[model samples]
Target: MSDTRRRPRHVGAKLLLLILVCYFLVPVWWLVVASTKNAEGLFAGDGALWFSGFHLADNLRHLITINNGEYLRWLGNSLLYASAGGIGCTIVSVLAGYGFAKFDFRGRNIVFAMVLGSVMVPLTALVIPTFVMMSNAGLTDTIWAVILPSLLSPFAVYLMRVYAAASVPDELLDAARIDGAGELRTFVRVALPLMRPGVVTVLLLSVVSTWNNYFLPLTMLSSSKLYPLTVGLGLWTQLASSNNGGGESLWNLIITGSLVSIVPLVIAFLTLQKYWQSGLAAGSVK
Candidate 1:
């Protein structure tokens, strides 16, 4: 009788999960299908699910060749900004979080409260002030404009603090101290290994945030040469709208470019998803 009652609930849960997965995957499926079709086929085709033409290779070639290969440049810039900022943010968050978790000092609660408060403040509200500061420092239109701001992820720091407190054992630190290990050495050797899961989580979050950052980069950078994929893609979209009647034929390029831009993000997520999952599980266990 209990097993019969549980079957309906299990079936219902599976159906709900299937619906959610389809909701998320449908747009991605459309993008993949649309990217293989030419402009005419993409707009004229009756079936959006089926590929009208196989222009994936051609579209990719043109994507790389447009504007003397500026798309590739934007891709490279994005990689540099995301990689540098993500790694730096992860390290800073981990160290700061570990310190906050393990050490006791005057005003610690006050300082942590301030950090937590900062998280509630939307980043959009700070754009103008940040732009002004960057302009004053003569950093506008530079990679520093993006990298510097992205490096300070308050939420990542907060996550690290919670993880460090829970995952890192007080006995371990005490043992390291008794072994005459310096604080820095203890952190590098003992704390870091145990904090690997949290570190991976922070790294993944930082990378995704940096990769998708559009508004901040749009506000900071004016030079096309310095643009990341998000900004560059927006520019292409704007130009496509303006040149709708012209023979510039950017529809194919824009769609193809959008598809290309998503590849890196997809690859990064797939590759790091295991690490992220393991990290979360480890932190939960700790």
Candidate 2:
């Protein structure tokens, strides 16, 4: 194609990309702006983007102090769930994926097929059944109810399996074996290091999913003390909606709480983004 003919198309594509970026980012921009304002300013501030106030500290203090600092507890619970689930899920996914990718065990194909099939199953659909099982086993209302289920991520397994198969060389495994390395030793020293990118990706995915999980925690736990950020914020919103004898606007607290709950996920993304991008690039190269 001639340069002149392609110029308009390029300009149009740039414009479309800009539009999509703004469409997705405007809400986040609004949130950052809104979080800085007090209850009155949030509703009264016409310039949601430009308006500023000194209520951020006050709002944060209130959020921390609400119901005797339950917000902090919720945050702690979320951190616990996300950390436990992320680490556990990453380990399980890596081991399972390594086996599937490298081993030649009997029924391997059938087992892989089953795992892939599980990936297609929606987690929401399994929540009730999972809850029933947890309840039967006397695990309900405990952190285990949330952590146990998140430890097994079918999608993570699939990702690890694909990445391992592509990135790990069979020759490397054989070389380690010849050098007097046991299977566990080879896996830990060789395969695991080689699969860093995939492991980081799975870790990020698992943490994010477990951090933002609402339905699972809600269904499994009835104690507010054990509630994660998602469920706690949800309960706050519900209370705000139901009560009217409030001094400060509960709506502001709800909005602020929602904003606070998002901070961890943002931090997790920023921290692990390099690993995910590098891993994906390396996997593609393989």
In terms of lDDT, the best-performing candidate is: 2
lDDT of each: 0.89, 0.90
> Candidate 2 residues 1-286, lDDT tens each?
6999999999999999999999999998887778778878887848887656768788888889878999999999999999999999999999999999999999999999999999899999999999999999999999999999999999999999999999899999999999999999999899999999989999998999999899999999999999999999888777767785243477777778888888888888898899989877875644
RMSD of 1: 1.5
Which TM-score value belongs to model 2?
A: 0.96
TM-score to native of every candidate shown: 0.96, 0.96
Clashing residue pairs in candidate 1, if any?
Answer: none
Error of 2 at 252 (Å): 1.2
| Residue pairs of candidate 2 with colliding backbone atoms | none
After TM-score superposition, the amount by which residue 193's alpha carbon in candidate 2 deviates from its true location, in angstroms, is 0.9
Per-residue lDDT of model 1, residues 1-286, tens digit only: 9999999999999999999999999998988898888777777859898887798888888889878999999999999999999999998899889989999999999999999999999999999999999999999999999999998988998999998998889999999999999999999999999888789889999999999999999999999999999999888888878875333467777778888888887888898888788777764543
Which ranges of candidate 2 are over 4 A from the true structure?
A: 244-248
